[model samples]
Target chain A: MRKEDMVKLISAEGFEFVIDKDAAMVSQTINNMLTSPGSFAETQHGEVTFPEISTTILEKICKYFYWHLQFASGKETEFPIEPELTLELMMAANYLHT
Target chain B: MMGGICSRKREQLVIENGGCRGVSERFCKIASSKWLGNSFSRPIVDCQPGRGKCPSLMDLCIYKIREDIDKYSSFSILPRDISQQIFNELIHSRCLTDVSLKAFRDCALQDVFLGEYPGVKDSWMDFISSQGSSLLSVDISSSDVTDSGLALLKDCPNLQTFAFNYTDQLSEHGLKHISGLSNLTSLSFKKCDAITAEGMRAFSNLINLEKLDLERCSGIHGGFFHLKGLLKLKSLNIRCCKCVTDLDLKAISGITSLKELQAFSSNITDVGVSYLKGLHNLTMLNLEGCNITNACLESISALVALAVLNLNRCRLNDDGWEKFSGNKNLKVLSLGFSDITDACLVHLKDLTNLESLNLDSCGIGDEGLANLTGLTLLKTLELSDTEVASNGLRHLSGLTNLENLNLSFTLVNDSSLKKLSGLTSLKSLNLDARQITDAGLAALTSLTGLTHLDLFGARISDSGTKCLQYFKNLQSLEICGGGLTDAGVKNIKDLASLTLLNLSQNCNLTDKTLELASGLTALVSLNVSNSCITREGLQYLKPLKNLRSLSLESCKVTASDIKNLQSDALPNLISFRPE
Candidate 1:
């Protein structure tokens, strides 16, 4: 729909990854921040700032979110990760709970 | 114009009533309209309807908002926060299955009850391990969960209640997995036959265990000795464990915190039951089929808090029956198949709070029923196979709430049916009387709410069977005898809700009975054994494909006839007995 309906996720290097609210909600942490019980800063502004997450790891997290959404809908495909990005990707996966 | 007028009056009511009920309907109208326009930040205000005198407009707005919210929640792609709320609703509605559990896979679930769910054993532990300490209570009773699956729950230190009844592969060793959960309070191993007395060593660390059920566990004989240190144990059930004797009760008799004990069909006798001498807090005790006699009742009567006492199949004669009259708190007393008689009825007159009394097959007769007249609160009186005829039923007229009365195998006939006409709330009547004829069945048409009617040996002619069609609520009809003919079954096939129909031993019934029974699409159980129907009659039952159990025993139908029948005929049949 509209760009305002989407949520903006800002990484450590000020790299903003804006996506549809439905796709971004595949990450449970982002979904909780945007739909917490009361009006917290992220829920009010529709934007979350992850200072600990780097630009590369946050971009991978956003891609993994879309992949999870497709996987949940019965789509079976390889979600390939490079050997060098494996350990860091796993760390970010634990943080985002993708 | 109506919307404007409704909004204007709603604004006035909102300003008057303020916070609780009338919390501004204008906000809901704006929020609902925006929710329809792709905005998901709709304020969800939870409210209990009919709590206050809110105006109809506000209630209507809440109803419409809830309807829209329900539509939004049913979608598969809901946000995590909103899905958790919807998950709570699904749990309350008892709709959580393996398929639905995937929707909230990321959220930490509080209670998971996968009892008897297929293929839930292997991956269930893997899923709970992901929960990471939010799991509190789980009941995987009668499922495929084994000891290894239960061992995975060791990480859940806060887990309180775990029930693994009928988990076939789980042994006493599997119980060792749950030893370290210090918060574990209740454990049920009902018919989980792998648990022995040695397996109980796993539960020695559970200091908070309050209730333990070991019904039908054959391996548990001297397990009571292992539970001596559990001071908080209040309820224990070891029903149908034949080896448990009075000596086992003597080992745990010092645990005065015991409130409920069920050892039905165990080898415990008067000496075993006497060990429960001064357990004042004991509320429910079931010693049905135990060898306890007259002397055991002397000590049992002292437990004043005893509310439910089931001595079914026990030898509770007249001498032991005298000790029960003083225990006024008894609400349910089952002395079924015991040697109690009319002399025993005089002692039960003072039991004013008795709600359910089962004296099935004690030969209470008319005189015994007279003594039970003062129990006005009696709701269920089961006197099946007793000598209490029509004359005794007049004493039951005062029990207005009497709902279930089983008078099977008595002198009840046409006159006896007239006696039951006053008890309007009777829902189930099992009159397996040989003397009841077509004339007596006419009196039964007045009991319109009857759901179960069993006349096992009664002779009801085809015309008399026509009178049964008036009971449209009848779900089960059993008239297994030699009297019912093809025409009698044909007249009663119009009962669209009939699920179970038994016409066994009706020798005069022919292939015409099959033709009429085929139209009964709702019939699940159909028994036409000992009839004159041959292989030709098997073709007529093609329409009864929904039958679950079909018995053609002693009929003229051959094994070759069953082989030749169409493959799709009676496809849902699970039980088939043919001759």
Candidate 2:
């Protein structure tokens, strides 16, 4: 993928994940940060760091992003999630505005 | 200063169009140039919504450039809803130019009501065409929209209601394109004089058309023949179509589902009403000034489902209204300015379900109203310009449900008001009695629920208005031709809910009254005609933000005072009558 079409997300354990910018921007908080009039430090380097989110949670979030893309396109299916991660995922969703 | 004026004008436009709903909430978002108090950089960057928090450097540079260019238009940084509100205000104010409209390109608008705008033309439609399938309602009334402009709307599929009233440039060819919009429910072509019988043929394609108003489209004679297939049409108005006789009514009589048909000022007579008996679903029928008589009333009596009927200014007498007794389901009966008398009311008294009975300017006196006393469900009783008096009010005392009562230009004196004072549920009372003075005004103090009280042409003085001060819920108070002065208005000043105050012909009113009137922030229409108010008195009325119509006619106001005052004093003023 072109450099402009992808973004790098760093989790708390320093695990880096490169995802399509379109999927990453699906999160309203990320969309606001990426498209806001004033440029922030994250926009300058095309990378975002989440200190509070762990590597496992971040991986689940990335998977959920792809799932959202499929669901928005009228693909109906269950988005399976581990019962233990449900509370953390919901908290992340609240912060991100989904 | 221009920003201030434009911002206030925008606010006024929104308030005018939205009527105190979303207008004020939307206006609160816009910060004008004066709000900065000398404009130190203007906070244009900070004014940006939260979504504008972290754009790339390239995007930031472009946004900065655009903000600098949009220096005068203070709503540059608002969100889509606020921008849409400003766009609405801009269209109504006739200030929406092509350049300014570019700002709201991303606005997701559902309804675009650009009615009677002088600046709008094909470009506005071109802008609307870009709104895609989301546009649900569009009113381009009295604009320069021609056939070409309407052709642009061919791409707008979801447009359910389209009104082009007085946009007479549109013809049969223009209407043919949109006729295929099966989802369209209402199509108003009122005063589009260019439309002929050929244009009406397009309506057959509008399968879902529920309401169609062709009022004053006199270009066609027998147009109902084309609308015969529009079986879904529930309401149709052909008012002022003189060519529409009983023959046209016979053509549209096939529309059995029609619930309301307003053919006011048409050529349809008694013969035409006879054709409507087959339309069993018709609930409301207005045939005012149609030259119908007792024969028509007899024919209309067969429509048992009719809940409302207006026969105002018809060639009717006592015998005509007698026929109405058969259609016992009538909830509203308007017989204003008719030649009917007490004998008609005797027959009408059987219509116990009647909720509204207007006998204004009818020859119904005390004896006639006695028959109406049995209609205990009667909420509105209009006896203006009749021979009713204090004696007649005794008959109405039993009608506890009476909410609106008009005894204007009647022989009702001080004693009459005493009988009416018992009606605690009376919301609106018009006692334009010539003999009414301060003596009977004390009795009205008990009516705390009164919203509208018209004591016009009465002899009530300052003391009488003092008694009226207790009616805190009064939204409208008309006290013309009285001894009401500044002290009287001081009592009037506390009624904050007052929207319409007609202190006309009260020659004793002066500056003190206007000073007290400044506190009426909710006032919309104020008429101080033929008063003693001087030009200097206007300074006291500067705080009336919602005041739209102010009539100072025959007052002592000078041309200089009016000229000296800025439009900001009464920014929403549309009608200003000064001598």
Query: lDDT tens string, model 1, B276-357?
Result: 8867888889887788787888888888999988887888788866777779899988887888899988999999998889
Tens-digit per-residue lDDT, B301-327, candidate 2? 889999988887687788856667888
lDDT at position B438, candidate 1 = 82
Top lDDT hit: 2
Query: Every model's DockQ, to 2 decimals?
Result: 0.02, 0.03
**Lowest lDDT block of 10, candidate 2 chain B:** B1-10
How many residue-pair clashes does candidate 1 contain? 0
RMSD of 1: 17.7
Could you give the CAPRI-style class of model 1? incorrect
Candidate 1 achieves a global lDDT of 0.71
Candidate 1 residue-wise lDDT, A1-98, digit = tens: 79668999999899999988888887778888888899799998889999878898788778766765665666745454444444355445556655
Can you list the residue pairs that collide in candidate 1? none
List the candidate 1 regions with Cα displacement exceeding 4 Å. A1-98, B1-128, B137-151, B165-174, B191-198, B225-234, B254-257, B534-546, B556-571
